[model samples]
Target: MMKSIIDILIYAHDGRGLGHVSRSVAIGLAVRRLFPHLSVLLVTGCGATAELIGEGELDWIKLPSYKTKISCGKSCGDLGPSNIDDKVLGTVRAESLSDLVDVYKPKVILADHTPQGKHKELLRAVEGSTDSKWVLGVRAVVGDVDKVWSELSADTFTSRYSDILWYGDSSVTGSSELDKLSKHFQKIPFETGYVSRFKELRNIVTDVCTHKKLAGVVSIPWSGEGTSVLLEKVAEVLGGFDISEGIWKVYMNHRDPRVCGVKKSFECHPNVYLEQLGPSFLTDLANSRSAIIYGGYNSLTDVMGAGVPSVVLLRGMKDGEQEEHAAILSKSSSAIVNVFPEDEVTVEALRNSLEKCLKTKVEPSNMVLNGAANAARYLAELAGVRDANG
Candidate 1:
């Protein structure tokens, strides 16, 4: 029997954070909704892929946990501390991708973030495959511009990728640098606004949350080893508020027990309701009076899209991506107040920032929020999938 052809195969390397996998799932879900006839498959290293994309929505291949570490400015991603060496792991993942392409024979392959994937494992898959349009999807504020320029301009990326997708608003994220780079390389990316999963996420939380409205929402998207101090400071600041009347809600992340200083049983504030992080987190935030959230691309875009006034807490990554995003958001939208220098975030500073944010009126950005759909549409076009009604 002949093997079934996959309409689209999306790959995401989630070494750094949930951003890559989240984007991939969002795009994959969008493709399913917009073009139901076409089949989509996801290949990712993130264990959270199943939870994010939901079961049975799309068939996916979970690759070996591949992570990247930059030391002395030269580092290819590898499965750290595993029994298998980096070279062996790379070869295994490369071979798996090659086999998937050979058997499934996808018409379009969408790669998120890294063009050639970690350690160039995806290069083999691309080279080994034929008649498939390979595209690269980049988010806004990709760390340093010089480093990104170097990666994008390399012969490897310039030669393989037929097109690029920019998942952000130009006015808000400042796409000029990337725009210039793409133009110089003659492979301009399709600006598809910010890819948001607000609706999808909201649906996930609705069953658990009984209330149709919430007064306020606070989200901390980080946890584990290095996050204790920051979490403590946040707890201290938020503890001062009076939530005895149940007017304020704190959506704490229970996904990891070592979620810093905030414990599930610890209630520092009166009348405050604490719950685990759910899909409803963003949905509730969108309907709340004010919000305090981590300054990630997805979080910021979702909040800004809903026109929710918010205080953005930056993790202060070494790459300065969050800081750059905060800076751009502060200038483009007046509804957000950003607290920088993650380590230096004090109770007073965070408290004052949130207070200020509460006073500001919500001013939603005018940028289109259908990036996932737009990206899916582009894939369909490339694959020659079209609506019968048209």
Candidate 2:
């Protein structure tokens, strides 16, 4: 039997935040809408990928997953309790990706964030598929400059990508970092200006700040060892506000096994309410009086694009991307306040920031927010789909 041809294949090795998978799904949905005749397949390692895809919107494949963490100043993989060797799992993911390429023979393949995919698994597949146009989709701030340039300068992987898509604006906070990358790479990438579900968040919302008196918004969808502590601090700080003020809304990932413990330990404040992370997260953020968010790309995109005054808690990852992003944005925008590690969070500081945020006047941002549609159009053109429409 013959395998069906796939018009577009998108791969996102997302094991942490919803950024990669969210961006991938947004582009896939946009492509499907713009070119109804085309078939789109999203291949990702995130278990939540399925939840993000709307019914009959796009086909998806979920691969075995592994999480990356920082330990002893070096990045390492956590395979959970599985006895399978880390290398063996890597091989399995690699082979699975290669098999999809060999069988489906997609006209175009898009690899998100990591150019060569997680553990360099997608490199072999890209090298073997001579007929497909393999593209790389990058976020606004990709950690260290030297490290990123060193990785992209490699001929083996750099030569394999036919096009590069940047999901950020050069005019934003991290423009200088992006400038360094462009100068080093010597190739101007197509700027998509912060890929988001703009039609879903920025454009469609006529009711801005429906919760004007609402204290703030907090979202930590991926739980960890310190998740409970963070939640406590949020409650403590928000609860400190006058009771007459509206409630503090928090969004969490109930699906994470660790979250149950976090929920149980949570001493819910009378003014704080917890809700599971859902499609309404961005919309809620847009309508919020203020937001307390981690320093992730999508979080920054939503907060900045919505012009919501926010307090960004830097994650201090090994790559220093989040810290770097928060630092840059702190310098560029007064609407944002940067706080350090979760272990040192002080209620006074958070309260002050929240107060400042509430007082600040923020107009909806004028930045380009139609990156998903822009990316879809570019991908369609790259695939030579002339009949594609807006």
Candidate 3:
């Protein structure tokens, strides 16, 4: 028998972008920090893991890449990204994963989002391997309720899992969504609220001073892969607003760096203040009058976590994840507004949404910022590792 050598193993698959991989890294970091002695391993598809997470801090396995396509779960779109043919790469990936689970024998397995993984790759391995307890971690809002509910109802493994973790706040997801999930799992999964990787603004005093300087500056952070049109339209429409210093603040990130190329930058008539990719974005999000962001898991969490007034625009594709999250954001707090029709997002709608976002209410509870640590603690408990920090 291959003995247990790893404490926890995470499968972070991504066909589209970085949200799943990012959250998985945050969890792994939290688990490693919370329980320093136990080794943590993450199996991820995002190539940027090394860039986001420091190398060698945790054991890692990178699967071959696959491009992700956005499809409305209930619609007639093509099924997501193509997988490596099972005969060759798929067989190796599956066998390699199964071998790892069998040989390393991790004490816990945390699967983010999908229970089966891309193309059901982890199904056999997860079911047949080790004495390892299984955990399914889901965000508060996962696309459309009907779509997500239907998918869950059809899944055999979700009902059989040892632990299911919901990383969004209970209030945001509400009883209706919870009730829907409870039917499939037969038990309500643990709700950890919204998880944030932030710890206050770097320096509240200095940050306040910066925000005062850019009194009219609005922050726009977006997923590079999907929101090119929305980004361009917003940039074009900034002409209507009175930018405080003739400088607009936009964040630079991996998926989309130059949101508007230099040509569009000049056309906007304001010196576009693009924050470098590496600087912590929370401070920028905090300093802005408001943020206009895509409704991806991390973006919503960050916006809500920072307690920033903002507008949530949804791609609503690929299972309606962002669409679901945007709806929840609207329901939970007045500060975050969801603007629809991402394809035709206009200056007027954005202007109207941003105005409302600026005056929206604070989070009804602290659940918005509670996810990362709570998840870490739960993972530790599942491993049966005594909480030495207590």
Candidate 4:
């Protein structure tokens, strides 16, 4: 007898950072690993993310990419009320998404954070679909609860849709916030843990200081957002240091290079090396003296897993969720200088922070790394598949 196939739709909102898209990819990979026969469709709106998701084990659909504006978890960049054009774009994106659902007819629809398309139309489409299990894939730290609740409550989307809200972070890491949100929504609230999708390169040295040479790996996207400014500041500060004595490796992972134009001269430094994106991002983190990073949960988790101390730069204009994550990691002695980009993000401050982080000893927190795989296993169970370890 032929085995039954499970079709899954993974929707990623591409309005802000690449976190949602990356996490969705990781989930799809996890699901595929659990059930080899499962057909996974990844629907995203980022061109760069689409490139990263090229010709994989899963099918792909690209929607209209929108600029993400995160203010206390209420996205307003391209999807919110701020943009006049997003109204048309949102409708178009929603119609395309609905069309995909209609044609593919997935057994399960997994929406990451926000529902795709317009509020009313998307809900209607999902509701009218035939026997589809709707799951809300949420990260551990969403944002300020009051702000998110107020925004979501006012929106028609929240009132019409219901889902099995699956959290992608450990309860230990996000218990406080998740507990608060649980009061309002009927959520399943399973801990999917922190999914670090970087390939575990074999023969790779897990130790950062193993290599005699000292290098700095700065991983941030080249967007005009606060992260880019932080990256430039770090480069400026690091340039003042005597790099002739040690290697300085800076790795940026975004399409736009103009954002880093201020430090264009550093690209030519004998000791300083610049790369657009590293396929082995985690490996580089493992090999570097320290990393300068924006506050994204995946990068933070990976650095912590590698036991590398880092300087976390929080986006100034966005919600304080990243700052919250940075604080937790810092409390565990895993990070240094958790501050907003606009406040005291100067060259002197960055240099001082980097010096401290490089000298500081950060013990890897197995709490998150171990929990991630277990979370994947739990998700498998939810999908009615037997756990491989079980």
Q: Highest lDDT, which number?
A: 2
How well is each residue in 140-235 modelled by candidate 4, as lDDT tens digits? 777763433555532523444455344444434546766755654545466655665543221123343446255567776535435455556666
Off by over 4 Å in 4: 1-6, 50-58, 69-75, 78-84, 115-121, 145-174, 199-214, 225-232, 253-257, 333-343, 370-372, 387-389
Q: How accurate is candidate 2 locally (lDDT)?
A: 0.73
User: Using alpha carbons, what is the TM-score of model 3?
Assistant: 0.79
Model 2: lDDT of residue 382: 78
* lDDT, residue 122, model 4: 61
TM-scores, all models, native as reference: 0.84, 0.87, 0.79, 0.81
Question: In model 2, where do residues sit more than 4 Å from their true spots?
Answer: 1-4, 54-56, 72-74, 80-84, 145-148, 151-153, 173-186, 198-213, 224-226, 255-259, 262-267, 331-335, 387-390
- Across 227-318, the per-residue lDDT of candidate 1 in tens digits comes to 56766676676666656313456765565556624563347556456766555565567667667777777777767666667777766556
Q: Pick the candidate with the highest TM-score.
A: 2
True lDDT of residue 264, candidate 4: 72
Instruction: Evaluate residue 387 in candidate 1 and report its C-alpha lDDT on the 0 to 100 scale.
Output: 57
Query: Can you give the lDDT of residue 340 in candidate 3?
Result: 70
lDDT of 3 at 192: 73
Candidate 2 lDDT tens digits, 1-390: 334498889998665678888888888988887787888999987776665663427789978777755453345777733446667777888999999999999888888866667777887797778888888788778876343466544454457776778887777654675566566555567888778653433333455555566667888867655667776667677767876767778888876676666564344567777787876676577677788888777777677766778888765566778777677666656557555676567878888888888888775555666788888989988777875543
Error of 3 at 63 (Å): 1.9
Q: Which candidate do you rate higher for lDDT, 2 or 4? A: 2
The lDDT of each candidate is 0.70, 0.73, 0.63, 0.60
Question: Per-residue lDDT for 14 in model 2?
Answer: 65
